[model samples]
Target: MSLSLEGKHALIAGGSGEMGYHAARALAAAGCNITLMARGSEGLTTAATRLINEVDGDVLTVTADLNNRLSIERAVDHAEESLGPIDILVHAVREDVNGYYDQLDVARLQMAAQTLLIGAANLVAAVVPPMQEAGDGRVMFVIGQDAIRGRPLGLGTCALQHGLLGLMRGLAREVAESGVAVNAVVAGLVDTDRLSVEIDQIVAHTRRDRSAVKSDLANGNAQRRLIQPSEIGATLVWLAQDEAKGLCGQAMVIDGGELG
Candidate 1:
């Protein structure tokens, strides 16, 4: 079945990054009017320009800090004013401050919580009311595989994903009767520029061969290959379409069998 989102308005948070940028492109290809929100105007403008060049659709870029509630409200409002009412919301925001439990600092932990959990919750709260009134909308969060299987050194990240899942479940139930679906896409180790940088750091810290470390990371998955950001973006586009109406409150894991 074709999942066409023609005429749909989509608002994507963190849309300047790899995953979010790909997601925006996919949605635009599926015929949705797209608005991407990020912290700075420069990255957002660049991403928006790329999408506009790639797809025959309207694309808007907004600068707003996800960590700030007021900023999020203004961003959403601005998007609505520019692109009509939002029919889809995709949150691909991530704050990856890697540290072990003993080494984790309070300020960093608080920032993590604010960005991942609180920011997502605020965005949901801002959009859900109008969506429910209209009796149609799709809200999706981008989670990680480490969320399914708990991580020792990645405790902060896992906590954030878990909290987001809980929030999604509650919102899904609350809006079920109104026909608004809320869900999450659980991602695996993706081969993005950011991940490449992270792998470099890991190799330096562990004093292991880059190839060996990459092999070890892939060994966690049956595919033995890192996922591409566009693959996740395709899945998000599918989930946001009208045909995915039955998929509410589900944390759909796309981990390439890594967690298993």
Candidate 2:
């Protein structure tokens, strides 16, 4: 019943983004040392400072590209060297693609694959082995709801999202006996900076009021509101705990009942 993560270390792959920031916040608050790995040093530093001010643990930032395998390996090594073994690995990446099926080309597809699938594989390869040797670890992916159901004009995005789910499930079974629980947090429309830009675009196209557009989008879900980043953060923290050991190979959907 305990959820204390004291003395643990967590590496958040997309730690500069909204979801990643919140996840790192929650994990750090739960007493986990945090290593935020992302491509941008400025954003990573900003995020690390925010975490340092808000939580109790060493906050380290590593600048690395998710599209490159060697970059991911080196970043993980740096984090482990700084904070010791990573007890939890969170892949909260955001790869934006023009998902129109007709507009999709090999380049776009490769970009998506490299970011979502191949980069994830590289990260797992880098961290999971040491976790297995230590006999305990938590691996989580923060992904979108498109992985479960398709949306119009988002074929490429949905395919990559589902591919991540497939990877999580397959790897969960493979590492079941290794004492490493692998799962994913399937998120819905969250009220983040990214969503604000999207809402602004809708406003510009429709010439509608910003609040009205937000309301209409919120009504897509039964909750009639957008999900908060902190909620997803809480979920990631919970899944990283020992209590969630049995919740492996599953997509913990946090869509405010939107999927229904």
Candidate 3:
């Protein structure tokens, strides 16, 4: 499959974070014009600049709070205006409230649902019109391992994650005739700068050795190591390619082999 994405325009929500940042770099390197959207301008600017320095693309930033519908609407409009119609859309946003299911509050649950599920639906709605008209579009969602198998880690996130599968499937069916594809990339133990800090916190809180913490993080995966953000980024790039037309409504697991 030809992976060349030359001239494609990509709108990435939560593009300033680890997953989004590398996806932007991968897409840009693959020849897609890039736009990064995040809640903060500082990270957006830094991410855009880094992408520009690393790859050739017209990189831009859009600041919007994902939980706010109006803010999202404006950001989508601005992103489309900045880079033209979005040929590729990557929703890499994540909202996690960790705790036992019973310990979570109703309001926090709602917020997580809005950010991961409703927010994604709204973004896709905004970008799909142009795609449907153009008869071509690729949408990829960055999801967590929690979406794949049930674990105690993110009891609060199961609803959002599972709902995402349903949302993507429905959207995929809706846009199939229009030559658009929607899918999720389920990632596990992604090794990022954020993960490094997280490892530190785990060791301090649990009074476990660094090695043990790292081991537990990779325990469910066969590879027993963290996945790189770029690996997921590259996977997103591949999913957006013309060769991936048949992949709609699918969840591409990038975890290093989940344990049975």
Q: Estimate each model's TM-score.
A: 0.95, 0.93, 0.92
After TM-score superposition, the amount by which residue 40's alpha carbon in candidate 3 deviates from its true location, in angstroms, is 2.4
lDDT tens digits by residue: candidate 3, 22-114 = 888999988999989998999898888888889997998998876677888898888888888889989888776666667777798888897
Error of 3 at 143 (Å): 0.5
Cα RMSD of all models vs. native, in order, equals 1.5, 1.8, 1.9
Off by over 4 Å in 3: 196-206
At residue 3, give the lDDT of candidate 3: 85
Name the top lDDT candidate: 2
Model 1 weakest 10-residue run by lDDT = 146-155
Which candidate would rank higher by TM-score, 2 or 3?
A: 2
Residue pairs of candidate 2 with colliding backbone atoms:
none
RMSD of 1: 1.5
Give the Cα error of residue 243 in candidate 1, in Å. Answer: 2.1
- The whole-model C-alpha lDDT of candidate 3 against the native structure comes to 0.84
